[model samples]
Target: MKVLYNHEYPRRVRLAAIGCGGHAIRNVFSTHPYAPIDLVAVCDLDRERAEHTGCMFGAKAAYTDYHEMLEREKPEAVTVVTNYDEDGRPRYPQIAIDCMQAGAHVWIEKPPAASSAEVLDMMRVSEATGKFVAVGFKKMFFPANVKAREIITRPAFGSISTITARYPEALPPLEDRQDLHKMWRFLDHIVHPWSVLQYLAGPAESIFVQRSPTGGTVTAIQFASGAVGSLHLDRGQGSSSFLERTEIVGPGGNVVIHNNTKLTFYSDGPKPAGGYGRSGDYYGGDERAALHWEPEFSLGQLYNKGIFLLGYAPEIRYFCQCVLDDTPPEVGTLDNALEMLRIYEAYCQPDGQHIRIDTEPGKVS
Candidate 1:
């Protein structure tokens, strides 16, 4: 709970950043104030952008070449928030591998790689170098997701049996799946919901997708834990509409998250006194009734800020915590990123054709 200013945490992990784009400026760099990190350097292909981000984010130096920055700064860790390459592959996997080879732990934004194979390669390098590589699967760290996890994992919720998520994203035609450029949108944003789903329900054992004429698709999933799940891709929704919704159901209880912030947990409702129609009251006591949470704009609190509420700061804090504790990250590890890639791949398959995924730990090969 200690909020240490960047300058006040000189003894914290010496860290540098690669990519001075909008996501880094708005979400990642702003988190330096709270995380256990020293913003020592910033790097980007564009010198002006890199220099400006360095000055803006309290970094001591800036460089055009990430290789030079990594070698010269010798930072204990590096954060990468770069975009995709010209071919539409995420630039992070290779850059992350390079950072680990340079003896620095890495935190990169998703999608971690263009394909599961690339993630597997990153995993090999991370293992060989003994440096941790964490992806910024920020949705998994959202306050709502964290609370839903807490609710479902609790003894009162019994065993989680089903999950349903609705997200606004389009699925490219199957013919274009192999072309990275054609599938860029699918590869990029699909990780958001898939990461959250995997966080709550370990991994999907089998998946079957149904496509729509409007480009959206609905996917049915069977989790490894005997849980059935569904992901509805609503590409036709208006931009003003809420983009994400998730519901996790267990024995006699359920949790629902709407628009990524508002959460309602309906704990087991009272049993019917005699028959279903014989119940006298619909509401339970305050403690037994559903609980709801959302940020109030009236308060000038950090929790009200999107950087925190959207989970950017906490994700950075978790990465810093892994470095300080000398432990590999549990949530955003390369393994989880690989799983996300597999899910994306499954969506690209022919509609209604179930694809079996290998969720077991280790490299895909």
Candidate 2:
């Protein structure tokens, strides 16, 4: 629990970065100051972007070739924030495997790979090299999601029975499922909610989908924990609508997260002394009342920033901490990514198709 200031951590993890795109610039680079990492070099295929980002982020070196940068800088870890290939497959799986082989742990961006098979390949490399790899599944680290997890795991919350999550994205028509480019948006975005669901509910056992003409999808999921869940992919919603909502139900209690910011938890409580008809006020005592949390915007605190509030900084911090602690990441690991990919595969198939998710070899039911 030692908080390392950026200037004071003289022995922080030596790190290199391999992208200078918009996400890298806005979220990834800005997060290193809050992590136990000293970025030593920045790399991108575009040399100009590499140098500019290096200068902006206080990296001492820049390179157009990541292989050369990995060899020369020898960072303890590297962040791969690059994008997809021409064929719409992510570039990070190969880059991560190479980084691990080069003796550096790796943190890669979401949609870890095009498929579960690719994620499994990266998992194999991680095992062989003994270097940990993690994907930035930021939603699982969001304050609201974190709080929901805390609430549901409490002994008083009873056994979790159901979950419902909503996210804004469109799954392409069935005809386009085979086209990687056509399905690119779905692949890139589905990981956000899938990560959150698996984080709270564990691995899913079976899945079925129902799609609408407007390109939205509602997936019915059955988790291994005997939990039933629904994922609503909200496409064509108004541009001004705030984006996500989630609710989880246990025995006599429930937790809800709205727009990824507000969290409200309702606990099991006795009825008002008389009855619903006799109660004069709606207020329940503190012990039985709902608990609510949302940030106040008046303070200029670090926690008020979107990077921190929405989870980018915390996710990066978690990755760096695991590297410093010499432990495999407990969350956001390759195994987690593999489970998410199985969910993604379920979506690629038509409704009513029975898809059994395989969490381990010979483990599917």
Candidate 3:
């Protein structure tokens, strides 16, 4: 795939943005040159932020109200990045609905909603409007994870049998789980590993979560594909440490991704140099050696940019491709958000017992 500059595309979708906050500025807007967008305008509740972002991005139109921006700009696509309300309800859901209703497709930031019902509501509206919506499930877009995805699905890897993910997350105390504001931290970040699991193993059908007194959790999940997986929530890990690890095991081999950048795939290759027990050397032939990949930062390259390495650019580029080609996005859809939120809701329930995740429509179970 070719990475195009803003001017390289023959025609570009007219794009406007809601919320010019730090994330929108640093990650979303920075991807403009890599995605095919005309950048019609910018909107934020604060006048100075709206104007400043518009000026910074060469968008001449600026509005404090998204409604005004949507109506006046007539953009074909809109990207939203907003924080939570006083009640801990994310602002992205309602804004995304508004964007879809205004005849534009949407690309919204994560923590898509506070509940599964909210995600369902977005789903219903998206179907009604014939507008596609993409959520920011960034981990699924990470270069290393993307490569792992490709490697595992190839015929060489055989069929996936298990998955293991480690991420630093803590479940709220049982008493605090009932409060949306208190549980906000869990909702905001759990998707990092959960989305990766879904992206690799498909939807989980059942889960049994066990929590520690120290606030950590270990969840055993049964995927609909019949692949079992475990998610390790390392609650007390230091802030400076590398954040994540994902490993997928198949009958033929296992692939591992470290901190979302380095990837190593161990296929069922031949034994060591002379044989398993007879070899003096541990190394094997190059044809059957573990395949490894990681980005090099010494040179200037699109893949080396934080925007690309962290998935911000790729996700935006994907959304833009879906809009440009008029194809529905298979990744980061509201259906995926609903599944992720179902798992979040399961965490709210009393742990120890297995919780079955339902796939039906309507209110959250």
Task: lDDT for model 2, please.
Answer: 0.88
Ranking by TM-score: 3, 2, 1
Best-to-worst order by lDDT is: 3, 2, 1
For model 2 the local lDDT of residue 205 reads 91
Comparing 1 and 2 on lDDT, the stronger one = 2
Q: What are the RMSDs of all candidates, in order?
A: 1.7, 2.1, 1.9
Q: List per-prediction Cα lDDT, in the order shown.
A: 0.87, 0.88, 0.90
For model 2, residues 286-351, the per-residue Cα lDDT tens digits are 678988999989997777888988799998988888998889998888888888888788788877
Off by over 4 Å in 3: 273-276, 360-365
lDDT: which candidate is best?
3
Error of 1 at 336 (Å): 0.4
* Global local distance difference test of model 3: 0.90
User: Worst lDDT window (10 residues) for model 3?
Assistant: 356-365
- Could you give candidate 1's per-residue lDDT for residues 1-365 as a string of tens digits? 45565557556889999989887898889888888887899998889999899998788999999999898989999999888888888998889999999999999998889888888898899889999999999988898899889889999898889999999889887788889999988888899889888999888899988889888888899999999999998877986888899999999699999998899998886654555777787564566667899878998887888988898998998898788887999888888988888787777778878899988776533
TM-score of each predicted structure versus truth:
0.96, 0.96, 0.96
Worst 10 residues of 2 by lDDT: 356-365
